[model samples]
Structures are given as C-alpha cells and as structure tokens.
Target: VVYYFQARGHGDYDSDFSDEESGEKSVQKTKSVKEDDLLRKPFQKAKQGSVVHRRFAAEEWDREEARKRRFHLISMDAYQRHKKFVNDYILYYGGKMEDFRRSGENDKTDLDVIRENHRFLWNEDDEADMNWYKRLAKKYYDKLFKEYCIADLSRYKENKFGFRWRHEKEVISGKGQFSCGNKHCDEKEGLKSWEVNFGYVEHGEKKNALVKLRVCPECSYKLNFHHR
Candidate 1:
C-alpha cells in the first residue's frame, strides 16, 4: 500500500508511508513552498550594499579586539622595554627620548604614547619626525607580533587568516640570541635562527612577507616548529 500526503495550507509537505515488497514500511518526506520561502528569507532581507557594510564592520571589530588585547598584554616590564627601544631609536635620530616623553604629560600608557607618536607623524606634518615615527611603529609592532603572535602557535594559526609560509630555500637571516618559538619548550638559551617567507592574499593582490624566528635544535622535530 502507498500513501500520498498533501501539504496543509502552510505549503509544507508531510511525511508519507509506503509498504514495500520486503514487508517493511518506508517513510518519505518533502519540503513545501513555505519552507523554501522561509529558507530564502534571510537572503531576501540582505540588500545590495549590506554585505560590504557587514564585512567592513566585522573587520573593524576584529581589529579593535586585537588592539585591546595587545595593549592589555603590555606589562610594566614590556612597556619599559618598548620605551627603551623607542628611546634608543630616537637617540639614533639625534633626538632626546626625554623630549618626546615630555611632549605629552597626559599620555600615561604605552598605547597612549604610540597613539601620540602616530598622530604626530601623520597630522603634525614633520618629515623627519615622520620617518622616526615610522621606524618606531615598525619596531613596536614587530616586538608585539613576535611575542604574542609568532611565539604562540595556536594564536598564530588562528590569526594568520589565509597567510601561509612559502617553503623555499631555508636560510638564516640574522645572528642573535633568540628563544625557541614554542611556548611550551623548556629551552631558555638562545639558538640558531632563520627568516621564512610567507604569502597572503590581500585586496585581490598577492603579497609576500618575512619573519625572523628561532627554533630549538632539540625541538625542531615538532610539528609547530616549521611555523617558527
């Protein structure tokens, strides 16, 4: 016996049962016009410009969250290190770090100092100061990216977006006392290092970037070591 079920006024189909030659009852189901309409409701509500707006909003939110987290991780010791680096860079440019610091008494946190420098570089229209500010900004971001992004494999993988390392000829780029990239590694001493190239897609363009990282000789066999 076969049963044909008609959908109610809502336009959704109901389940039906059929008796087969094997003496077992078989069930069938179908979606109704109402169900199809409901499924398409979200797409219908999305207007032409809404997708781009939503994407921009999401990107802004991600950047804001990252900025907040980065600032939060800046401890007094880290901040001091950053300050010293900035001061040294300023001295190289024949400027007193104290002068820069004294330029803004209200800027208390590291974030404030960075923001002030960034603003000064862009809005103040000083060419020399602009170059110095660019160097300072690069160093500041590099240190933080190394500590928080590169060293933590999980975080690196998560925040890497679609960027990936392009394994070409392996070459050591710098000489320095550097710790292992693995956060869980027990090695505290400096080890040999290498700079690796990474590729990513941005704004419909392919771009290449490099990062210097060290790996523990003993821990090189680990899966995450390649990322370092």
Candidate 2:
C-alpha cells in the first residue's frame, strides 16, 4: 500500500507509492535540508562600526554637502544676473528699482516682486533678450560645474556622491535621466535618479562587485535586498 525509504542523513526521508488499478509506481521527493540549516548558521547584519559601512557613510555625507554648496553658489550667480536684468528693465520703464525692494527681507523677495511685475517691464522683444540671457547663464553655469565641481572624483569614489560626476556628464551630453534598469518595476514617480552599486559583504570584507546601474528608489530597495 505505502512504502517509506530513509535518506542517508538525519531528518531525511522519502516515500514510494503504487496505484492498485494501473499498477503505476510513483516516488514523492522530500525537501532537502540546506547545509546552512544543518549547520545552524545565519546571515549576520553589518555592524555600525564596520569599516565598509563607515567609510561609505562618511563619503556620502561629504558628497551631499559638496553638491549643496555647488547648487547654492550657482543659484546665487543666476540670481545676480536676474536682478541686474530686472533693475535695467525697471529703470528703462521709468520706475525706481528700490521701490520694489521689501524692507528688511532678503534679495530673494526682491527678485520675486520683480517677477510678479514682469508684464509691466517686459515686451515681445524683451522676451527674446531674456531667452538670450538665460542661454548665456546656462552655458556659464555648465562651464563652472565641469571645471570646479567635477574636476576631481577621488573625493567620492566609494559613495553615492561618485554618481554625481556621471549624472553631470550625462546632463552635459544631453542624455537627461537614464531609465531604471528594471523592466517590471515602474516606481520612479518622484524619486531622484541614482546610480547604485550592487554588491555583497563576506567575512567582514566588502567584495567589489559589478558595474553600477541607473535605478529608481523602489528598484534600488530590491537590488540592495532591503527587508523593510
């Protein structure tokens, strides 16, 4: 009716059966025990003090600070040009530039007031002029970025900041944002584009892994094997 066969090791067994009418013989495969389970060994999380984690974390922080500083400087430069244009337009239209300034507030508010009153000073020909200025400003910004911010990669080789160089290159080359490598995942709605390295740690040492890929935040979570 039924037969049982013992496997070679402990907690291992198999079953054999026969149909009475057709006389067909069948064997049911037993689930094999993994070596890890047998040895009671489990994967351990990386410790906070681990060299790999600490090194990467510090690099990431530095890269972020650098990026912020770069953006702040560029924005200030752009704002200055914008302010000069606004002042010239207001003076040409017989209006005092100082009249638009908000008392005790920052230069940003002044820029905002000028923008709100743009229609009063800007005409069709001035639109073309503004476009020219914008183009010139963008070229200047790009030149500065490539010369200063991206001249060195040694500062961010091991962290997410290294991706900035690649991103900047792509932007300069007109490539825009690269698609996330995952085909089935469509989770890039509001997440910033990131170049992520996929790798593993073994015996307290991080193994250098494959090429970095462009990925959205959701796909990154899966690639990193994050549990949460």
Candidate 3:
C-alpha cells in the first residue's frame, strides 16, 4: 500500500498536494489574515480617536470605585460606633447595679436587679426605639464578639447580660394577634393587638449556652452561633 500510494504521488514529493492539505493551508492563511486585520483595526480606531473617551471612562470607573469605598468606610465607622454604644450601655447598667449593692440592695437576686435596672432604662416611648436598638445591638455585638473576637463573654462570665426581649405578653384577647414578623408564613394572620416587649438582662449564666451570660439572643442570631 505504501509503495502504491508513493507511486501515485509520483517520486515522494507530493507533486500534486492532496485537496485536504490545500484546504487546510487556505484556512490557516485566511485565519492569519483575519487575526492581523483584527489586531490592526483596533489600533487604527484607537489612533483615530483622541483617547479622551477612554480616559473619561477610566476616570469615571475610579470615581465610582472611590464612592463605593467611601460608603463602605462610613458603614464600618457607623458599625464601630454602634458597637461602642452597646458596650457602654451594658457597662452603665452594670455600674448601676453596683449602686444598688452599695445602697444595701445586695440581698436582691441578680435577675431581680437586672430587671429593675432595665425598667429604669426604659421609658413609655421606648417601644418605638426598641427595633432600632435591637438592630444596632445585633450588628455591633456580632462584629465585636463574633468577627473580631474582641469581646470574650467567657472572660466576663459574671458580667450582666441584657436583651431586647419579646415575650408572650399575654395572647391577644379572643383570637391571638400575629405580627408580620414570621418569615416562614408571610400570609399568616390572626387577631391583632400590641404586645408589650421590654428590654431585660440577667447576671450570670443562662441555661442556654448561647444565651448564657456571654451573649444575648439578638447577637447570637446575628453571629450565626448556636445558643444552647
């Protein structure tokens, strides 16, 4: 077969190249020409233009990036400030409890003192501010205690812990009232009435390890840490 094909091609030089090779060469040449054209076209267009548009686009992109960075910085600053606020508030309440002790209220249970202090911190209009406080507390506490590992509750085991609490403050008269707070059931509805939610704290450990003296429920959820 080799001899036969070699003879057919006449003297081993492929005097008449096969159609396939010819077609392949033609494709290669066309591809090279197209690529060269593509390369040159971009340069030609760029040369025709003053590069002003490209510079403007680059500058705009930089400005947009800078604006995004500024927003991020501001958000981070706000978060840090809020964290300090929560820490200070907790410390203030703890200090207030010291006052109670000095005033001969040392016989009061830790829970009792915490409850009393929380009541003192609250006003009738406190309900309106509860949600905002909740959000701020979650954000800052999560960052300090979870992400930055700044606050080790185990270190301050005996420190007073507080919470923005929502309890079963008596089921609504007649049918129960459900707030739209349930995520799983958006359409869930029931009898409606305002439930009193107040902020409270406890000194020392709670049964739930997550809700123990180390961290509050709101911060636990924010940090995605298991409570108990």
Candidate 4:
C-alpha cells in the first residue's frame, strides 16, 4: 500500500509510496526519520493528527526574485532624480564658464583658457539637489555595503552623476549647510569634515552619531548657515 506522510513543523515520523495510479501500497515503515531528513523521502508518515501542507520550493525562489525586482525599480527612480540634478548643475557651471572664458580672452593665453575652464568645473557643486537624498545617501551607502555586501553607490554606472548629488540637495534645501565648518574662518569651501571637526569634536568621542552630533555650544556664536 502507498503511504501518505503528514507534515508538521516540529514533529517527526516515517513511512512508503507506490505508483498513484496503480494504488498499490507498501506494508512496512522502513525506519524512524527526523523531520529534516524525511523531506525528500517518498512514502512517509505524518505526525499523528497533522495535516500535509504541500509546498513547491520554486514558489519561495519566485518571491525572492520579485523582491529583487522591486528593489531595482526603486533604485532606478533614485537614479533618474540624480540624473536630473546633474544636468541642472552642469548648466549652472557652463554659464559660469562662459562668463570666465569671455572675460579672460583678451589677457589670457591658451593655457589660461584651459585653466579657467577647469576652475569653473572644480568650483561646481558635487551633488544633485534633492531634499533628504543627502541624509539618506549618507546613511544608506555605508549600511548597504556593510550589511548587504552591495557595491558602493559609485558602481551604479547608470547613475553616473554620483552620490555628490545628495550634497547639493542638502545645500539647496537648507536642511544643512555647505560652508567650511570652521567658526572663526569665513571660508565657504571645505569638506563636511571640517564642520564636525570644529563644531562636533566633543560629540565625536562617541562612536555613534547620536553622541557625536550633540549641538555645538560654540556654533551658536556663528551664523546658522556657517554651521552647515
């Protein structure tokens, strides 16, 4: 006689199966088997009073594939937004370059023309301007790499604009500032590193940002924009 196995999450048992059409059956329970080992075995017994819940492993794999597809879709949306910011920033720099090129032409050599062009490019913003993207990128990029083993955002070739677009968003939105972090100095250019160094040094002692980001008492002395 063919035997049917009952499925239970935590219970274990044993049994046999014959061709379903013939309806012939096996007479013996071959051996005691644990739940994990018995999965592929044919003609198994279910735990007493348990029901068989059949599952095809392919359904699980399909669910995982769907999740991956959704993730890529979200990433593509972010990429498009980043691309738009890059185009806008490029236009802004191009205008500045045009002005500089015209002004330098009379007294400038071929070398000066090239240098001025490069200067404009260097002075341009590093990020696309979209609110909250900078904050998200700041936390997301490192987390994604460490936990998921994903490549850096730099590897997203389709988003050639780079994560710097997030910095531009922060600056434009006023949620943060882009100026040098030093309080005494008026320099508008420097990495965000300087801001934390001058303003958040005491806060940095803690490895966690919550502790490191405590408000700087000295920052109140400077203009709010300078704190950015």
Cα lDDT, all candidates: 0.48, 0.45, 0.41, 0.35
* Per-prediction backbone clash count: 0, 0, 2, 11
Give me the displacement of residue 183 in model 1, in angstroms.
4.5
lDDT string, candidate 2, 1-228, tens digits: 899776742347433432332332222212233443465536754345745677888999999999997786577777786786787788688788677777865444534544333331123553565554444433333343221111112322233222222335544543323434343433435434433443444335454432334456755565444334
In terms of TM-score, how similar is model 3 to the real structure?
0.17
After superposition, which runs of candidate 1 have C-alpha atoms over 4 Å from their true positions?
1-108, 112-150, 156-178, 183-192, 199-207, 217-228
Choose the strongest candidate by TM-score. Answer: 1
Q: What is the lDDT of residue 67 in candidate 4?
A: 100
**Between 1 and 2, whose lDDT is larger?**
1
lDDT of 2: 0.45
| Superposed Cα deviation of residue 131, candidate 2 (Å) | 56
Which candidate gets the maximum lDDT versus the true structure? 1
After superposition, which runs of candidate 3 have C-alpha atoms over 4 Å from their true positions?
Answer: 1-33, 37-48, 53-228
* Residue pairs in clash, model 2: none
User: Which is superior by lDDT, 3 or 4?
Assistant: 3
Q: Would you list the clashing residue pairs of candidate 1? A: none
Encode model 3's per-residue lDDT on 22-121: one tens digit a residue: 8899999999989978778543643444455888899999999999977866777776866666667778765443433336555765445444434323
Error of 1 at 79 (Å): 28
Q: Can you write out model 4's per-residue Cα lDDT over 57-118, one digit (the tens) per residue?
A: 57777899999977866777776866655667778765443433335446855444433322
